[model samples]
Structure formats: C-alpha cells, structure tokens
Target: MVTDRFNSLGRPARLVALCLLVVAVAFLVLGRWDLALAIGAGALLGWVLLKPVRITWAIFAVAFMVPVTIDLGYPTNPSYTLLLVLFVLAGWGRLHRAERDGWPPRRIGAALLLPFCAVLAGVLHWHGVKPVVVGVAPLLCIGVLGWHLIEEARRDPKLILRIAEVFTWVSVAVAALAKYQTLTGTWPLFDQFAYDWTYTSVFDPTRAAGFFGHPIVYGSFAMAMALVSLTIRGRYWYVPFTANLIGLVLSGTRSAWVGTALALGIWLLLNVRKIAWRGVATGVIITVVAFAAVAVNPSTFRIGTSEPPPTWVSPTEPGTKPSPSPSTSSVDSVGVAGARMSDPVGSASASARFERIAVAWDGITRDWSTVIFGNGPESSVRYLEDVGIGDGQAQVFDNTYLTIWHNFGLVGLLSLLGLLLALFWRSRSLAGRLIIVGFAAQIFFFDVWLWLSAVGVLLLAVALGAAEDRPWPTLPFLNGLRKRRPRAPETSDASTPGFAAAA
Candidate 1:
C-alpha cells in the first residue's frame, strides 16, 4: 500500500516528498523547530526550483523582503535568516551553481576576506570573540552571499533586468507602506519607541521609518529603489518612481536625499550622450515640484531630528547625575531651519558626526598597534563608554569608513576601499557606477553597513549594475548605447534567405 501510494505521486511531487523526508530527519537531529522548519521550507522550495533558481534571484528576494523580518524573540531579521538558508542550500549544491563556477572574482574575494583575517588576529591577541562574531555575522551571511550573486550577474547579463524588476515592484509596496505609516502614525513593526511611536514629537515631527527600524535606513533604501526604478520602462513606470521619491522625502533623511541627488547627477553626467533631454527636463520639473511642496510645509518636512542629551555625571562629584540640559542646548541637530543642502554642516547631527570622527581619530591613533591592527571588531561601543560618548548604547560610529577603520584599523579600511574601487572599476554600466559612487558618498553621513536591509539594497544595486559593458535594459531609448556586436566575415551563404539569423 505504501509503495502504491508512493508510485501515485508525480515526478515533482515525489521529489518534494523526498526533500521533506530528508528535512524531517535533519530536523529530528538538529532539534530547533523554528529555525529548522524555516530552513527546511526554503530548501524544499529551492530544490523544487533547482533548475531555474539562481543566486541573483535569492539575493533580490532577500532585498525585497527586508521590511518583513520574522521575529523569533531575537535581534535576528529576515535578511540574515533567509541568507543563512541560502548559504546552507548552496553548501548542499542543490541551488546556485555559482559555487561550481567559482564565486567572487579574485580581487573582490580577497578584499571581502581581509576583515575576517584581521578579526581572527584580534581574537588571537585576546580581543573578545563575541563582539567580533556579532559584528562579522552580517558580513558572512550578507557580504559573501552578495558576492556570489554579483559573480552570477557577471556571468548572466540578462539576469540583471529580472532582478531589477523584482526589486522595483517590491519597493513600490514598501514605499506605499511608508506613506501609510507616516500619515497614520502607526505601522506593523512599530517598536521604535517601545509600545508607542508618538514619542517622535519630542524631537522633530515624525518621519516615516516603514519597517526598516530607522528613518535614515528607510530613506537610503527608498533612494536606492528610486534610482533602480528609473531604469523601469513602461508607460506607468513613473508611478513607482514617484512613489519611492515620496517615500524618500517623507523619511526626512537628508543624507539619503543628498545621496539620491548625487547619484542622479553623476549618472546623468556619465550618460549625457545616451539619455534624452526630455526625460531629464521632466525629472527636474518633478523634483522641483516635490521640493516646493515640502518647502511649503516646512513645519512637518523638517530634517535632522534631535536626539536626547547624554546624561552627565561629573567626575568631581561621583554620586550625582545631573538633570537634563536646556531645551535649545539639548537639540542634537540644527532643526528645521538647517535642513537644506546649502548648509548641511550647520546641522548639529553633522557637527556631532564630525566630533565623533575627531574623537575616533584620537582613539584610533593612540598607539601604532591600534592604527595598524585596530582595537577590535565591535570595539566602538567600549571606546564610546571610555571616552564618554553616550554610554555603550551608541554603537555605530555614524560613518561607515570610520567604523571600518576603528574595527579593523588601517588594514580593514584599506581593504574596504579596495573593494569599493574594484566594484566601481569593474562595473560597466552607468547605473552600477552611480550606485557605487553614491554609496561611497553616503557613508560619510551615517553608518551604512550596520543595517542588513541597507546592505541588501547595496547588493541588489551591485547585481543590476554588474552587466558586462551593456547599457542597462528596459529603456528602449538607451538601446542606442548598447555596443554593436562584431559581425562575422561575410560569405556567399550569408546573403541566402535560408540562413538563420544569429540569436
């Protein structure tokens, strides 16, 4: 009866049954039902679609689902969880032949691995392993997985458009949700200020964070999606494009705004001959109108929301913690008046970021050993406590470059710069180059690497931009920019009607 029932299953069904059976056995052995079930489900799906599923698709999927992290009473999110499952499935060779294809071109691979080597050296020198592990976990899960996707993109040029379409549509939904959250003052993952999100009024007016945990992250992501959506080529493409732009403005993150402008400007400059004048003019008109709308309502469109002042305990009197400082003095940012591109330096947030850099420089260069090898991964929290920079809660250095230098010293910083340079140099399309330069510029404003969603967006950008010397697809107008394939030497048979056209 069992044999007959097993025979009744079709080929695909039989494979799925076998996959589930294997997963069941593994689950019984591993014994973490939540993780096991999640991974098993992912693996089953991957195995079923093994013939068609590529690593690039998985990367894009992770990027799209960043707003939907499944909480399991831990700090973990969907980005890490999904990437972990992909990594495991890759290990089994049931998905992503990028492994067999030798993932991550050599120079990029070396750049990716240097930080881990530095971390290992630090751990051997008696630095805590837990912090390094925690800090590098995302690197292992997201960074390496992303590199594999990039390698895949390099191999399959057509896959870039597929990835971009998936990302663009999903980002439209994300932007819509951000708009909803901003207008309603409520959202599904609204745990930013404990039980209520209304406390944002204590600073500047509320900014839309979506499910990305922070307004800055949401803004940056929206900026990226907007840029990608520009490549979309339908009569209604502007709908998603405009949606992301609205999301970016509602986020009230000046850095992201600046990044978007910088990226667009750079891309335009790079492709001046390729793009049409009408498109640029239309875009400028739209952007100006959007800015004007925001400017008209400056009260609610404020950027640079102030954070609470750090509690001070005087060294002279060890027993007392002072009361909160003056309201004006307590403002951590330049408020609404200073929220323009003309005066980013005037903002208190920018000033604080500069101050952090100065402090980090002093700490990082205290000794030759620290300069060369770094204090350790995730040592910024300890450094912050030692230097009195808002206790250990202020983990990020507010500058990704600074964070890298602090965590891995000059070695790590140089390694990161090298990787960025490689990406920019290797990326053939204008879009890819813009993404690289834009990310490089934005890292100065905040710690771009601390968030998984942000990293996923970066990876997605890399994949779309990794097309080999081809003009980005989707825009028929850009077809003229594509390089003409060299023609084979003409023969007598070439003129014959019977000759099939080259694919």
Candidate 2:
C-alpha cells in the first residue's frame, strides 16, 4: 500500500518540482536573485522528484530557452550561462555514450577547431589567458551540444520533424512578443533601451527587438527560425509562419530582410520540382503587383522618426572633433522599410559601414604577422578604440567577417570560411542548405556572435542541417527534396563508425 501510494504521487511530485524550478529560474532571469534563491530552496525539497536530464534533451532545452533568456548587463545574466553549464555537465555524464556515438564528424569538428586554435595561438602570443578562455569556452559548449543534436537526430530520423516543430512553436512565441512590442512600443520583460547602439536609426520606436537586445540580431534570428519553421507541415502552420514573417518585417533589419529573401529564394530553387509552379507564379505576380502599388505611393505607408547621426567623441582628447555624423535622411524620408530596399550607396549607414571596413582592413594589414596570425582574441575592439571609431565605453562591429578577421587573423577567417563552404557542400537536405545560406547572408551585416540567442539558435540550425535529412510522409511533395545524396567514400576526418554502419 505504501509503495502504490508513493508511485502514484511520483508524477505529480515531479510536475510540481519542475514548475518550481522553472519559476525559480524565471525569477533569477528577472534579477530577483533573492526570490529565486527562496523558490529554488523550495524546489530542493522535491529534489528526488527531479530526474537527470538526458544529454539530447538538455541540448534541446538550451536551444529552446536561449531565445527568451537575457545575456547582457554589467554582471551578465547567469541564466543562459547556467544552461550551458548544465548542458556541459550532462554531456560529461554521457561520456560513455559519446565514445559509441563518436565525436563530431571529424572533418567539421576540425574545421570548427582550427579557428579556436588560431585564437588560442594568438592569445598565447599576447600572453593573455583571459582572451583564450573567453574564445574557447563558447566554442567548446556550442560544439559539444551541436554534435549531440546531430547524433540524436541521426539515431531517430523522425527527430528532425520534432526539432522543426519545436522551432515553429518557438518562432510563434518570439513573433507574438514582437507583435506585442509593435502594438505597444514597449519591450517585454525589460525596460526599453534608451538607444539602439548597433543601428543608425537609434531609439526608433517602431523597430521591435522581441527578447534579444539588438533588433538586427533578433530579426536575423527570427528569419532563420521562420525559415526553419517552414519545414513544419502541421495544419494551421501558416498562422505562426505569418506571425514570424511579420515579426521579421517589424524588426526593421534590412540585412535580415535581404538574408530572408536570399534564403527563401534558395529554398524555392532547390525544391523547384516539388513546388507548385502555378501557385508560386501567382504569388510572385501578386507580390510584384503589391510592391509596385506601394512603390508608387511610399510616402503614405511611411511612419516613424529618425534621430541624428551617432557621434563617437574620443575620451583621450575630450575636445577632439567627432567623426562626421552619418545622415539619417533616408530613414527620415521613407521610413525603415523603404530605406531597407533603398540603394546601399544612398544610405549613410551603408557608407559608414564601408568606411569602417576600410579602416579595419588598414589596421589589420598594418603588420603582416598581425594580419596573418592576429593580435589576440577581441583585439578588434581595442584596435577600433585606438583608431577612434568608438569611445571605449562600447565596441561595435557591424560585420561578423570583419570581427572574425580582426580577432583571429587571416588564418582564422579562412578557416571559418572553409567551414561554411564545407557545411554548405555537405548539407544533405534542401532546408538545411537554406538555413546555412540565410545565416551566411546575415553575418555580412552584423556581428552575430555577440548574442547567445543568435549564436545558440544558429548552432542548432547548423546541427539540424548537418544531421541526416529525414523525409516526412506528411509532406509527400517535399519528399523528393529530402532525398539524401549518396555518401562519398570514407575520408579521414569525415567518417564516423556508427554513421557508416547506419548508412
């Protein structure tokens, strides 16, 4: 009778514990650390109710939670960092499983490792241990988590659809938050930032960042998630799909707009045979007509105000002249959406980006050794400050390629480029290839690695893309697109014993 009662209580007890833990973590993220501790203590009472999280589930949890978690502020929020730690711990506990699962496909793993090794070498050359740790820590966490996601998906082909379903729901939540921000002009869960430091249209009320601090990062991520969500074949899937699309537009991120278009185009082209040409043609025609109608009277649709150009006053010389402020006239005249499609040369933001790229290139190439091997991790910020692009209070790089080049030198940049190409080339599914293309396009516009949500989701997308693409009978039309390409002969770095056996 005692055993029966205890067994009957197990599930409800576990549910209560999980709810307590979640609430405690939410409190912690909200900066109610004291309340979090109190709630967390309550959760400890049900410690036996908490079961050990599987490594795969732990990674999925990290991926799902990243979009909602904050990673900024002076002390930095420990919420996302804690998830990463838990993921690492879970993976550590599953070491025996990893030996059988095999390490990340050795080639891609090595490709990913080369840049970190370059960063380590560069940091060591500078005798700065902190930079090395900072560089390697995220890399290690992302790599391990991504490897397991791939392994798990391979083991269960149906897992890919489950992953897509989760992403679709995540997109729905993020999109809903963005819509809320649009309707109310109020940031959820946090106070609105006084200014958006990353973009020219600073403090624009119309641009919704959702949960991520930066609109560009949020928009780019939303685009990727929106694209990934396309794989979902559920009834009424278009509701969330439309929501994500609207969120991406409201983000007012021109680069994300371009990337999404590029990715969508790629996806369509790859699945051209599977696509209904009549429907696509009709949609394209309707879209073109609507665009033409809007183009004829853009002023009617235009809304929002633009602030004056951003100035970077030097700290060393208080009286020194600031760099000429970039013009926001384009933004003012046509609004963010119109300016988004405007010619690059006409926008001061684009011009400023070009100028910065030139300056960064000049600085990076000043010494061949530094150019080839890099000064150290995060040397880009110092170089930017020294060169007078920023006031040391904040360092911003509008370009990920530039930042990577600045931090890890030519070798690191090349390694990353190689890795991207390899991933694209090796991608077995149309959607996987589309995801990579989208991510690659967006990186040219901003430093994507700065935000945990942006980078974490991206790594998840890459893992899904790299995993064996599984066919969904629900989407019989797309089955042709999901067909796996024949495997190439075992290459030293690419072959996995388990993957080979399964293949």
Candidate 3:
C-alpha cells in the first residue's frame, strides 16, 4: 500500500513535501534541530509526498546556493544532508518502478579501497580514527552518488544540460559576491560566518577568496562554472561565463590558472568545428593587446617588478662567521636545501611548498611499513611536527598527489589515478566531459573537496556522469565506446503494391 501510494502521488502531495522540506531547513538553520528532524521524519512517513526528479533538481540547486551549516568548523554544507534524503527517495521510487535497478560499475570497489586502507592504517598507527573517517566520508558518498546520477541520466538524457545551466547560475552568484567584495571592501559570506576571509583587493589582500574559504578553492569553483557555461546554451549565457573568468583572475592562484587554461584549451580543441571563427579571432586580438600593454609598463599595470627580490636567509649569529652568498647558477634552486624547481624562483611561498614536499617525501620513506601502508590518515601533521617545522600544526603539503603519496604511498596513488581515468573514460556526454575536466584541473591546486563549497562541484560531476550515454566502464584498458544497435531492414518497393504499380 505504501509503495502504491508513492507511485501515484500527484501535485498536492508534492506541494506538501516541498513545504515540509522548507520548514525542516528553516528550523535547522534557526537552531531548532529537533523540530527540523521531526518535520523531516513526517515528510518521510507520508511516503507519497516526495517527487524524485523534482527533489533531484532541488538537491543540486540548493546545494550550490546553501553551503551553510548549523555550526562553524564542521562540514556544515547541507548538500550532503539533502543527498542522503534524495538517495532514500530514489531507492523507494526504484522499488515501485517498472524497471529494476542495475548494479554500479566495477571500478567503485577499487576506488572504495582508498578509504578502507585509510581506516586500517589509522587503527594500526594508533591514531584516533574519527578524523580519518570524516576526511574520507564525502568521497565515499560521492562515489556511489556518481552511479545513481548516471542511472537517472540514462532515463532522461536532457538532465545533464539542465544541471549545467544550474551550475552556470551558481557560478554567477559567486562571481557577483567576489565583485561586490571589491566595491564594498567586505565579503559577506565569510564575514557573516566569522571566517578569517583574507584578500583585501588585487594589491592588498593575498587573493580574492569569495564565499569559499580560500582563493584557490574559489578559483576552482569559478573555473567549473566557466566550463559549464561554455557547454550549455541559453539566455544571458555570456554573463556567468565572463564573470567566472574574471573571478578566476582575481583568485591569483597559479595552479588554478593553469588548470582553467588547460580545460578551456581542451574544450576549444574538442569543439573547434562548432566555435565561431570571428569570436576566436577577437579573443586572440584582445589577449595580445592586454599582454603587450602589461609588458610595456609593469608598474602602470600594478603587476610584478622586472627585478627579482633578494633571497631571504636567516641572520648570522652575533659572533659567528657569516655565510658567503651563492653565485648566479645556484640562485635558481628552491625548496629546503634551497634546491628544487624554480617557482617564483626565489620567493618564500614557493620555497615552502617544495620544502614541504621534500620533507614529506623523506618522512614516509623511513621504513617499509611506513612507505607501503603510509603513516595513516591525516598523519602528515604529526610527521611535519616531528621534522621540526613551525610546531608542525600549520605547515602542510598542500599538493594532493604529494599528500596522498606521503600518506597512502604507491597503492593509494595508483588507486587515485585509476579513479580519475575511470571517471574520464565514462563521461559520454559533452557536459560530463566539461565537468570532469574542470574538476580535475582544480584538484592539482588543492584538495578542493575538503571544503563544503566544493561538494556541489563533485555532485555536478556525478550528475553529469549519471547522464552519460556510455555504460559503466571497466578497467581503462577496455574502450569506453557504447556498442550500436543494428539497423532495421528496409522494405523493398515490390513489397508495397501501390509503389510498385506507380513505378
């Protein structure tokens, strides 16, 4: 009876469900956690209330807009909460539907191993397991989420474009916030939540962090929006696309710039035939003009100086002999020994990143167990402290690959690579391709998913993956091309008497 009720629930039932969800969210935000929980429970009890497709749309749209939470410091974004609710409704819908659900892709098992290993390593290393669990939980949820979204997409191929349009609007909202900060000299989202939102302007602040915690994260978010905008066509399309590009520039993160550049280039290459030649030429001309002007007068443009700053070394002790300055050849070296690749060449931040990598690499290679299984989840902090770097509480290897390499070693690295490849391989639709490219570009800058704001990004990819026409791919060795159905045989003219007589 319950299944039958939900199967045929009409507009009035959906309206009631919508009202209940709104109240539940309002109650939660107002700190009435009990009331929110009760209302949510009541909505569920009415089995016929929730509409799966409409709820799916709300989950994404709200997730992008409402990264807010009941508390600070926790993963307070409610996208995760909405996702769990959606999954419940989806399961119920499937049980009473005409078609049976299929099993998820094989690659998920391999992907899930990363978390399992994290938990096991935590137990063995004697570190508290809670942090490890929290760190990997979102990843695990998104893993299954991709499969479910793909299933939904198969039923309605248009969902991917609709989701892309949703993302374009989300990107515009965030970009407007970033621009507003420039005008008002205050960022409401961060300031409202009492976050230490840095980045005063293009000159004073380190970078424009926007609603997201870090400028790099915001850049990634903007880059995602830009890619989605380019892929989807509709009214006022250029607004969000241009806004996201401007926001990316304000982010001032080199890695994000590189990622966005690469994704944009790839998108252009993939759709070169369809792109307008005049627009491309105009973009090229404007870019050249901008570059030439910046080159002519760096000071006028407020860009960096032509001369490099002097290298910073610790002052010699009062009575001790001073060290000789290194020659020109050695100046290029960065990192701890002052000997890594040139990034900002002689700057402090560049030195810190490479030094963290060199130090992190050294810490993990000390023994076979440490090297193979890694020191455990979130174990990088302890190692950093042990190595005598700023009390080890703050300094971290921001590089995701390096961090995973240091934490989970070769196996983890390989598993991560496999997942990335699998996701790329399975992206059949153009929109899905754009989402994957945008997300992959951002991750090189930071573990963007670590923050609440980025959950929508991952969810978008999941939704895109859901809409992909390709079947769940196996190992990357197998080609991702979907097999075509055979064409029906054509009836000959002789088979039709009217046609034959006319001839």
Candidate 4:
C-alpha cells in the first residue's frame, strides 16, 4: 500500500507535500496547530491552482503572516528575519534566471559585493553560538535583503515607493493603537514589560509606539517615511507627509522632531530648484493657515509639562511599591491638568542629546580598538558591561555616526560614509537627492545606521543610484584626447605668396 501511494504522487506533488509537511512540523514545534492546519490546507490549494505567479504570491503572503518578532528573553527581536528571507528568495530566483541566460558575471558581482561586505562584518563580530545565531545571522539576512532589493527590484521605482507607502500606513496604525492604549491605561500591544518606562503625557496623555519596540524608534521610522512621501509627486502625497509629521510630533521624541525638521529642510532645499515658486507659495499658505489655526485654537499642539516621577520611584522596577496616587488638586498643582504649556523650541532633550554625543565620543576616545575597528556588533552594551554600567542606566549614544564609529570602528564607519557619499553624488533627480539628504540629516541624533529603518532608506538610495544619468569618468589611458591623432595644419583658402609658390 505504501509503494502504491508513493507511486501515485508525482515528483512535483511530492515536493508540495514535503513543503506542507515542513510547515506542519514548524507549526507543531511552535505550538500553533491551527496555523499548521491552515498552512497544510493552503499548500494543497496552492498546488491545485497551478499558477506560478499565484503560488509565488501565496508564499509571500504566508511568509509575511509569520510573526517575525517573538519574545525570547532578549533585547533584540528577530521579526525582521522574515523580510530578509523573502528578499533572499526573490534574489535567488533572479540570480538563477540570470545564470541560465549566461549573463555577464561582472554585473552580478558588483551587485552582490555590498551584501557580502555586510556579511563579512557580521561574521568577523560573531563570537559564540548565541551571537552567531541571534545577532550576526539576522544582520546578514538584512544585508542580503537590502542588496537584493536595490540590485534586482530597482528597475521598478514605483514598486519601491509602494513598499514605502505600505510601511507608512502600518506605522500610522500602530501609532494610533499605542495612543489608544495610553488613553485607556492599558498595556501596549507590544513591549508590555517596558510600559512604565514610557514618558507620561499631560494634555494628550499617550505614548506613541508605532509598530516598533520604542516610541522614538517608531517616530524616527515615520519621519523617514514622511520624507520619502514628500519626495513623491501626487495629490495624496501630502496626506501621508502631514500624518507622519503629526505622528512624529505626538511621539514626544525631541530628537526625532529635530531630526525630522532638519531632514525636511534639506529636502526642501534640494527640490527648491524644480519647485521653487510652488514651494514658496505652499510654505506661505501653510504658515498662514497654521497661524490662523493656532490663533483660533490656542491649545492645539501644545507641549506637555508633566513632570516625571522622582528618580527613587523605580517605576520600571519589578515588585516595587507604587507611589501614592496623587489627588486631582495635586496633579493640577504639578501642571498636569488643563494648563497650556508653551512649546519649548529646542528643549532639554536636544541639550541631553548633545551631552550623549559628547559622552559617546569620550568613550570611543578612551579605547583605541573602538576608535579603529569598532567594539564589534552590539559591542557598546558589552563595553558598558565592562565599565559596570547597568543596562537600565546606560547612556545612549544618540548620534548614528558616533554609534557606528563606537561599535564598528573606523573601517565600518568609513564604509558606511562612502556608501552614503556615492549615493549622494549619484543622485540625479531632485527627489532622489532629497531622499538621500533626509536620511543623512538623521545620522546626527539617532542610532539609525544599525536599524532596518535606516537600511531601507539606504537601499532606496542605492536603487536611485541606478536611475541617475551621471556618466563614469574616463580613465587616463582610455581618454578620447589621448586616442585622437593630431590634425594636419590647415592651409589658407586663398594661397599666400610663398605658400602658393610652394603649392
């Protein structure tokens, strides 16, 4: 009976069955029997469909359905691995097709090197089993995904833009959910344990975590998306740009706000030549409308003045006694009630970021190895551990450039800078330049260099490089001037006395 059943199933059907079996096993291992059953059913249906495009789309959907972020008692999450896998699969397909066609290998070689470099960096930092499995592997995955998208999918700029749009929408939804949780005094959907560490809001009374582990991270992500949206020309472009801007403001992340503003400024400057008059008119209209709105509603977009609990309170401490709940009058006295607070234009947060930058610089200077090669991936945490700095109390290196230099050493830092410089120089269109500049602006105050948020922008920058019209400089040996023969001296049309005689 087993031999007959084996004979009944053809090779393709058997392959499908094997994949289904693997999915079932994975689901069983993860204790998700329902998901396993669904996958099993989907596999059978997908085989019946027999359309390659449909099957591919179904696989993509299933891959995305898998939750990338699972709590494994670690600060880092593996949610992004799913994206990396999808990109790798897509890249592999492209590569296989290219190989079959006997395409020139040099083009593919250049395309693959960036990701290889990133993988090399990851491998060099790999220490034990945990580091290899968790940190380095995940980073390599991201690098491969970035390279795949930039090199393969870049022919369709619209597709890349659509992905950015989707990410923006997702971020908005997450931010809204977070705000809802904050208002209802409920735990956030993600990062439940870190709820108390969130800053309290006064007027709005909400924390803004938009699908990210932290509010600031979400805000920075939104800001980058906003910049990208602004680069696109469309009727609905302003909607995302405005929403993302508002979301960033509500995030109460001072560094993000500053970074966004600076990025926007750079974007505006880059696009000024093309849209100078329209931009001026738009700016004037927005300013006038904003002033009118503020005049009519003084409380709109007011900054919160809620004071943080005393340092001794230990809000995030497990099993710590809660402080005595304050009365309404006490809350009122502390400026927590309906008192409108003026926005502190460039507040203490900005000052604190500057201080952190200085501290990171000082720390890097103290260690020669850190200054040269970087401490290694996520080495700042280890470095802090060596210096007896607790994770909770550790000072953040807010600047991405500083963070990169401190962690990856000079080689990694310069490689990143070179990549950025190449993108900037290669940017031909105004929109492309704006996108690159916007990302560059954020490097001063956020550890964006390591995050997928920045990686996406970097990938987009690389893709834009392909669309640029700039020509490669001629080599000294290949110069046209060097190849051209000297022209013979031209004779006068009307022969002069001596020349005519010689003629």
Give a tens-digit lDDT track for model 1, residues 1-503: 98897788689878877877787778778886866666666564554445434444654564545443334433365445655655553343323464476543563465357557456536744566777766676566555655555556666777776666566676678776765654443444444432222212222334666667667777767877777667545346676677778777777788787888888776666557676888879788777755543334323445876444333223356533232223321211223324555577886677777778888888688788778777777778677756666632243578888777777788888878887776666665555666666677777778765466677667766666555354332233434433354444676444421101210
* Model 1 CA deviation exceeding 4 Å by range: 1-55, 68-70, 74-83, 89-108, 120-125, 191-205, 231-235, 273-277, 288-343, 385-388, 391-393, 471-503
Candidate 2: worst 10 consecutive residues by lDDT?
Answer: 324-333
Q: Is candidate 2 or candidate 3 better by TM-score?
A: 2
Error of 1 at 151 (Å): 2.8
Instruction: Check candidate 2 and list the clashing pairs.
Output: none
Candidate 3's error at 137, in angstroms? Answer: 2.1
For every model in order, what is the number of clashing pairs? 0, 0, 3, 6
- Residue 407 of model 2 has an lDDT of 72
What would the TM-scores of all predictions be? 0.71, 0.71, 0.67, 0.62
Q: 157-251, model 3: which lDDT tens digit per residue?
A: 68766767867887777766665554343445454453222222212232456666556667767777776776664677766777677677555
Candidate 4 at 482: error in angstroms?
23
Model 4 worst lDDT window (10 residues): 329-338
Arranged by lDDT, best first: 1, 2, 3, 4
lDDT score, candidate 1, position 68: 37
Error of 3 at 268 (Å): 3.4
- Each model's lDDT comes to 0.60, 0.59, 0.57, 0.50
